[model samples]
Target: MHLPPISLMLLQVLALHTLVFCCQASTFTDQTDKQALLEFQSNLSPNSRVSLASWNESFDLCNWTGVTCARKHKRVSGLNLSGMKLTGVISPSFLTSVSLSHNSFHGSIPPEVGKLFRLQHLNLSNNVLGGGIPLGLSNCSALLNNLEHEIPSELASLSSLVLLSLRRNALTGKLPASFGNLTSLERLDLAYNRMEGEIHEMLFLGGNAFKGQIPSSLANITSIREFDIAACDMTGSIPLSFGRLHNLEILGFSYNSLGSYSSRDLDFLGSLNNCTQLQHLGVGYNRLGGKMPHAISNLPNRLTYLFLGGNFISGSIPHDIGNLESLQTFKVEQSLLTGELPTSLGMLSRLGRLQLQSNMMSGEIPPSLGNLSMIAELLFYLLYPGLDYNMLHGSIPQELMEARSLVSLNVSYNNLTGDLPREVGKLENLIQLYVSHNQLSGHIPQTLGSCLSLEEISLNRNLFEGSIINIRDLRDLKLLDLSNNNLSGSIPGHLVNLSV
Candidate 1:
C-alpha cells in the first residue's frame, strides 16, 4: 500500500536526523581519543629513548605509533606504547587500559589511576617498572603486576584483588605482614625474589628437564641466582662459565648424568668460589666420580649446605673442609671417601648435621669432636652425626658422647671396639643406637636407661657380655636386636615394650 505524501516526508526527515546524530557522536569519540594519545606521547617524549616523532595532530590518530583505533567510530581501541624505552612516570590518563604489558616502560605507576572512573581492566605487567605498587590498583578485579623494590603494607588494602602475578623479579625485603588481610585474593606468585624466606622446596618440571646440556651461554646471564636442574636427565659437565654468575645462590645438579669419573669432573667447584652468595649445593645421586678436587675446599665460605652424596667420590676429604665456617649439613654419605676424620672439622662450630655414613673412612674416632659439642653448648650445635658402615675403629671416644644434641647414633658395621662409653647416657635426646655388627664388647651401659627417649637399640652381633643392663625406663623402645651377644641374665619383665 502506498503512503500519503505527508507520511513519506516525515519518514525521510527522521532518517536524515539519525544519520547526522551518529556522525556527530563518532566525531566526538575520535577527537577525544586523538587528544588522549597526544597527551600520552607528550609525557613520554622527553624521557623516552625511542622516537615518537610520528605522533602528531597533522596525522590521523590511528596512524600514530603504537595506537589502534576502531574501524567504525575511529576511536582508540588500544595503545601499545611498549618498548618505547620510556623512562618517565606512567601516563595518568588513557582512553584504553587493556594490554600495556611486557614493555620496556620504566617509571613509577601514577596514583592518579584511581581517577579513571570508567576504567575496568589494567595490566602493566612485565616491564622495567619499579616503585611501590600503586594503591589505586586495589579497585581492579585482577592484576598482573611487575613491581620491584619492597612491597608496601598498603597493598594489603587491595582486598578485592584476585590474581597477583609478580614472578621472576628482583624484589627484596620482608613481605609485609599485612598481606594476610587480602581476603579476596586467589593467587599470589613472588618466585625468584630475593626476600628473606623459603622461595621454593622442589620445583618439579612437568616436562623433560633439559633441551640438552644446559647452554653454556646461560652463564652470560650473570644475574641468575638459582640453578636447580636436578632430575633433568641431562649429560655433560657443568659449564665452567657458570662462575661468571656472581649472583648464583642455590646450585643443584642432583639426580642426573653429569660428570665422568675424570679428575676434572668437580673442577667446577673451584670456579664457584667466586659466587660469594652461594649456598645449598646439591650434586648428589649422579654419575659423578673420581676424587674430590682440593678446589672443593676453596668453595665460598658462605656455603652452608654441601650434598655430595650418592656418587663415586673417593680419596680423603680435603683437610681445609673447616674453611666453610657456615657449613650446616655436610652429606658425603654413600661415597668412597677414606682416611681419618679431619680434626679441623671441630672448627665448624656452626655445623649442625654431619652425615658421613656408608664410606670407607678409617682411623679412631676424632677426640676433637668433643670440641664440637663444647662450642655447641655456647652457640653452634649438631645432631644426628651418622658415621655408620665405615672402617672407623678403636673405642667410641668418650668426648663424642658429650654431643647432647645427638638424637640418633649409628656406628653399625664397622671395626669399632672397646666399652660403650658410660657418657652415652648424657645423650638424653638419643633415640636410636645402632652399634651392631662391630667388635664392641662390654656390658650395655646401665646409664643407657637414663635416655628415656631411646627407641631402637640394636647392639646385636657384638661381644657385649654379662647381662643386658636395665633399659626398663625406655617406654618408647621399639626394636631391641640384642641377638648374638653374650648377655647371660634373663630379659627384664618390664622390657615388654621392646620387640626382640
Candidate 2:
C-alpha cells in the first residue's frame, strides 16, 4: 500500500521508542533498597573472605549475597548473613526475615529495627550485640538476642510472639506485669541475666539475681511446661499455688534460700503432687530444712531427676521413696539425715546416682543397693555411697561390689567392723577406696591389688593385720595410707621405693 514518507518515518520512530522503553523496564531495580544495603555493607569491617563486592549500583540487589527480594516489587524480603563473621552495625531495612546470628555484630540494637513493620522473624543470637532490646520488635514472631538491659514492658505488645530468647545477657530489673498480656507466648528464656524481682510462667530465668518469693501469678499460666529459676537468690517458700500448673514437666528452683527447719516450709511438696506429669524437680543447694515430707514419695511417678541435696533436711528418708519407679538420680547429700539406709531405695530399677553423704545415717549399708544394675555414671564418676561420718556398723555389703560401675567408695570415719570384701577387687573400675578411721579388722585383702585403676587407698587407723601384699602392680596408685595398722613386717621393697 502506498503511504506518505512522513507516515513511514512516524511508524519507524514509534517502533524504536517501544524498543528503548522495554529495555529500561527490563533493567529497572529498586535503587533505594540497593543503597540501603550498600550503606549496611559500609558499616561492616573489611573482610576479604566475606566482602560485599557485588553489592553496587551496577547490579540488582536481589542478586546480592544474603539478600532476597520480592518478584513483583523487587523490595528486600529476607537478609540472612548468619555466621559470615560479620562485624558491624546492622542497618535497619524493610525486610520480612532478618537473621544475623552467629556473627560478630556489636553495639546496641538500633530502635529503627522496629521500622520494619513487616518483620516476622529476627534472630541476632550468638552475636556480641549489646544494649537493651528495642521496644519496636513487638511485631516480630521470634526475637532472640544477647541483649543487655531490662526486658522492655513494650514487648507485651508482641501478640504474635511465640518464642523470645535473650539468654546469657545482663538484663536486669523486674519483668513487667504486662507480660501476662502475651497470651500467645509459648517459650520465654531470659536465663543467665541479672534480672531481679518476681516472674510468671513460661520463664527460664535461671542463673539470675532474682530474689523474693516465686510469684503466685505463675499459677495462672496453665500451659507452662518447663520452669527453671535455679541459681538465683530467691527466698521464701515455693508457692502452694504451683499445684495448679498440672502440665508442668520440669521445675528447678535450686540454690536459693527458700525454707528453714519448720514443717510449713515443705508443705508445697504436698501441693506439687497434683502435677501428674512432673518429671525433673531440682530444689537442691537451698536452705530447705525440716524432715523430708513423706509426700515426696507421692510426687508424680513420672519423676526421673530428684536433687534435694546441700540442705539441712533431717530425719529418715521416707521408705515410700521406692515408689518412684522411674527414678534415676536421687541426691540428698550434706544434710542432717538420720536413721537406717532404706532398703526400699533398691527398688528403683532406674537408679543411677544415689548420694546420701555427710549425714548421721546409722545402720548397715543396704545390701539391696547392689540390685541397681542400671546404676551408671555414679555421682559423676566419684560415687560416695557414703556410709561415712556416721554410726553405720556392719560389714561392707558384698552386694555393693556387684555394681561394676562403682568408681569411688567412701565408708571412712564409720564404726564399720569387718574384713574388706574380697569381691571389692572385682570392681576393676574402682579408683579411690576410703575405709580409713573404721574398726575394720582382718588382713588387708590381697584381692585389693587387682584394682588396676586404684589411685588412692585410705585404709589407715584400721586393724589391718597382714603386710600389704601384691600392690606393686598398681602403678597408678598415687596415695596409699596403711599407717596406724597392725602390720609387723619389712615394708615391701616396691612400697619403699614407690613414688607416693
Candidate 3:
C-alpha cells in the first residue's frame, strides 16, 4: 500500500495491456468464423438461410446445420450438409470436406473440391451430379471420397483411404488397374452401377457392381472379407486363384453370366476349398456344368448358405454334401443334375431349406430325409408352389411328417399314390400346401381345416375322389386351386371366396 514511483505505475499499465490483447485475439477468431458463416448462408435457399442463421451464433458454430466442432470453441471440425436440398455445386473454397449425398446438387462435382486438402470423407452418392470424376481428388490425400464418377487414376494419390462407397451411381468405365495404389482401403462398395472392366490382381471390389472377368489378381487381396460383385453382368470363368482368398467371408457373384471354359471346368470350384472363412457363396444363374467338386465338401464348418441354382450343373449331388453340417439353405433348382437324392443329405442337421426341383432326380424319396428330425430342431420350409410341370415319381413318405417344424409342404407335379396323411394337418404353421398333379387320393381330409395358417393350397389335376369337406373352415386360405380332381359332390357354396 506504499505509494510507489512513476516507474512502478508504468509496469502495472503494461500488464493490463497484455490481458486486453489476449481477449481481443479470441474475439477476432469468433468474428472470422461468423464472417465465413454469413458467406455460406448467402448461397443457401431462403428456407435454408433462415435455418442455418438460427444456429450460426457469433460464438458457436456447432449449432449450425450439419456442423460439428472440436474441443475448442467455434472452430470448424466436421461439416455434414448432406440431404439439405442444396442446389449449387460444391464450393471447396468455403470449407474442407463436404457431403452432398442424396441432395439436389445437379451439376458436375466441382474440380475445385480437390483444393480442400484436408478433406477426409466426401460422399456425393445418390445425386444427379454427372461428368467424369475429377482427377484432382488425389490432392486431398484422404481415402474415403465418393467415386460416384468414373474411377480416376488420380485417386491413386489417396494412399490413406480406408473406406470408399460409390454404389448406386451412374459411374462407368474400367477400374484403373493402378487401384492397388490405395493400399489402405478395407471396404469398397461399387454395387448397383454400370462399372465394367477386368479387375486387376491384388485388388478387392467388395460390394461393387463391377462386371467383366474377375481378375486373377483379386486372389491376392487376402485381407478382403465381404467381396460382392452380384448382378454385375460378369462373364467368363471363375479364377482358380480365388482359393487363395483365405480371409474372404461373403463371396457373391450371383445373377451374372459366368460360364466355364468346358464341361469339366468345375476344377476351379475345388480351389475354393482353401477359403476356410467363406460363409456365403452365391454363384447362381450361371452356365457352369459337371459334378460339383468333392473338394467343395472341405469348406469350413462355418459355411452356412450355398446357392448354385439356375445353372447347367449336372451329375449326382455328392454324399459329401453332408460335410457342410452348418448348411441352412442349400438350393440347386433348375439345374441338369441327374441321379438319386443322396441319403447322406439327412446329415444336414441345420438345413432349413432344400431345393432340388426341376432336375432329373430319380429313385424314391429317401426315408433318410426323416433323419433331419433326429439331428436337430428343424427350421425347414419346403417351397414348391406353382402350376403343374415336370414329373417326380415317388410315394408321399409318411416319414416326412416327422419334421414337426415344417412350414411349407409342396410335392406337386410328381407321380405318387397315397391317402392324405392326417398328420399333415398337424403342421400348424404350414402356410402353403401344394400336392397337385399326382395319382391317387382319398376323401379330402376335414383335418386339413385345422391347418389354421395355410395361405395357399393347390391340389388340382390329381385323382382325388371325394366330397370336399369342411372347406369353409380353412379360413386362412387365400388361393385354393382344386380343379380337375375327381370329386363327386356339388361345389361348396361357402368356398366361393376361397378360389383365386
Candidate 4:
C-alpha cells in the first residue's frame, strides 16, 4: 500500500515485460523447430509409415521413437528413419543426428543436409540414393560418424568425425584431396565404389591405406592400421617409406594395375622390415615382377598372411623363406618362378596354406614338405613340356601323405609317376583331390574310396588300371572324374547310390 516513485515503478514494469517477452520468444523458437520437423514428416511418402503423432507439444522428443533430444532439452539430438522404405528427398529443415539407412530414399543428397550444425551421426547407406555427395555436409561440425554416398570434398571440414562407412554404393569420382583433413577419422571404408586416382601423400597415413609413395608426411599417425585401397587402379611400386610405419599392419593392394617388382621393386618391401607389427600383406593380382627380394624372408616375425598372387614374380623362391616363423598363409600363384622349391619351406611350422600354382618351378617336390603338417591344402598347376625341360621325376613322396591335416590337394599336369599313395586315405578331412594328367600307373588306390568326406576326386589322364570297387564309402562325393584313365572295369555300380 506504499506507492513507489514513478520512474522506479515504470522500470519494474518494463523489467517484468521484458522477462515475459523473452519467455514467449523462447517458446516460439521451440514451436518453430517442431513445426519445421512436422512439416518434414508430412512430406514423406505414405509408404514411409512414420507417424508424427508421437512428436507432439506435450511429449518430449527424447521419449519419441526414432527421435532423441539433446541433454539441454533445447533441440532434437537424433532422428532415425532407417528401414522405413522412404522414397523422397531429405528435408533440409530437420536438423538432427539422422539415420535414413536401409530405406528406398533416392535422388541426389541435398546440399541442405549441411545445415544440420549439431548433427553427430548421419547414415544414409543401403539406399537407392545417387548423385554427387553434397558439399554442405562439412557444416555438421559435431559430426562423429557418417555413412553417406558420393563422398563430398566439403566433408573434410568436419574436424570431429571419427568413423565413415561409404561402401557398396554407386559412388564415382576421385576422392577429394581434402580427405586428408579428416585427421580424427578412424574406420574409413570406401570399398565397392568408383573412386580413382593415385592416393595423395596427405591421405597415406603410414600403416594406414593409400598406397603409392608412402605419405612420409602421414607417418606420424601411427595409430592407423587395416588400410585397404584395393580395386582402385593404383599403379607404381610401393613406397619404401612405408617401413617407417612401425605399427603398420594389414596392408591390402589387391586388384590394382601395379607393375611387377624386381629386386629393385622390393626396396619398398624390404623397408617394411621396420614394420615389425606388419601382418596380412596382400598384393595379389598386381603386375609385381622380378625374383622376390631375399630380405622378404626377414619380414616381421609376426607376419601371419602374405598374398602375392597373379603377378609376374620370377626367379626361385628364396631359400630363407623358412625364416618367417609366424607365416600362416604364403601364396605366389600365377608367377614365373623357376627352379626347385626350397627345402627350407619345411621350417614354416605355422603355415596353413601354400599355393604356388601356375608357376615354372621345377625339380622334385621336396621331401621336407612333410614338415608342414598344418597345411590344410596344397594347390599347384603342374606344367610339364615333355621329359626334357622340367620332368618332375621320382615317386610322390609318401611323406606328403603324412600331412594328416591336408583337406585338399591339387597337383595336375606334370610327369608324376607311380601308383596313387594309399596313405591318402589317412587324410580324414580330405574334401577335394586333383591328381589328373599325370603318368601315375597301377590301380587307383582302393583306400581312396574310404574317404567319406571327399567331395571331389579327379584321377583323369592317369594309368589307374584295374576294376573299380565299392564306391558306397564315398557317401559325400559330389563329383568323381575317372575319365581318360586306363582302368579296365565298368564304372562301379555302388557309385550310383552316391549323391555325386
Model 1's C-alpha root-mean-square deviation from the true structure amounts to 18.1
Identify the candidate with maximal lDDT: 2
lDDT tens per residue, model 3, 1-500:
11112233333332333343334455345445555556545555565555455554543566766877656555565667676766544444333455666665555655545545555666666666666677776433222333355777777677777666665666677788787766666556666566666676434343345557777877666667777777766778888888887877888877878886367656777777788888898888877777766766777778888889888887788878889988877888888777777788778877777877777766667767766754445344442222123355667677776666666777777676777677777667678888887884777778888888888988888878888767576777788877898888787788776654
In angstroms, how far off is 105's CA in candidate 3? 3.8
Question: How does residue 473 of candidate 3 score in lDDT?
Answer: 68
- TM-score, one value per model: 0.61, 0.80, 0.78, 0.73
Model 1 stretches astray by more than 4 angstroms: 1-208, 375-382, 497-500
Poorest stretch of ten by lDDT in candidate 1: 198-207
Residue by residue across 1-500, what tens digits does model 4's lDDT show?
Answer: 11121233333333343344334445444555566566556556665544446766688656666776556646554677677666665555344357877766655555555544444566777776566666766533222122344456767777766666665555555667777777676446666655555566334222222345434555554555657666655677776666776767877777776765655555668888888889889888887877777877989999988988788777888999998988878888777778887889878877777888777777877777777774334422121111122335567788777677677777777678898888878877778888888889998777887777889888888888898756687778888888887778576677767776
Q: Write the per-residue lDDT of candidate 2 for residues 200-307, one digit (tens) a residue.
A: 433678888777777788888777777888898888888899899888898999888888657677788899899999999999988887887999999999999899
Winner on lDDT (1 vs 3): 1
Each model's lDDT: 0.71, 0.77, 0.66, 0.66
Model 3: lDDT to the true structure: 0.66
lDDT pick, better of 1 and 2: 2
On TM-score, the stronger of 1 and 3 is 3
lDDT of 2 at 149: 68
- Where does candidate 2 stray beyond 4 Å? 1-44, 51-84, 92-98, 139-146, 197-203, 374-384, 473-475, 495-500
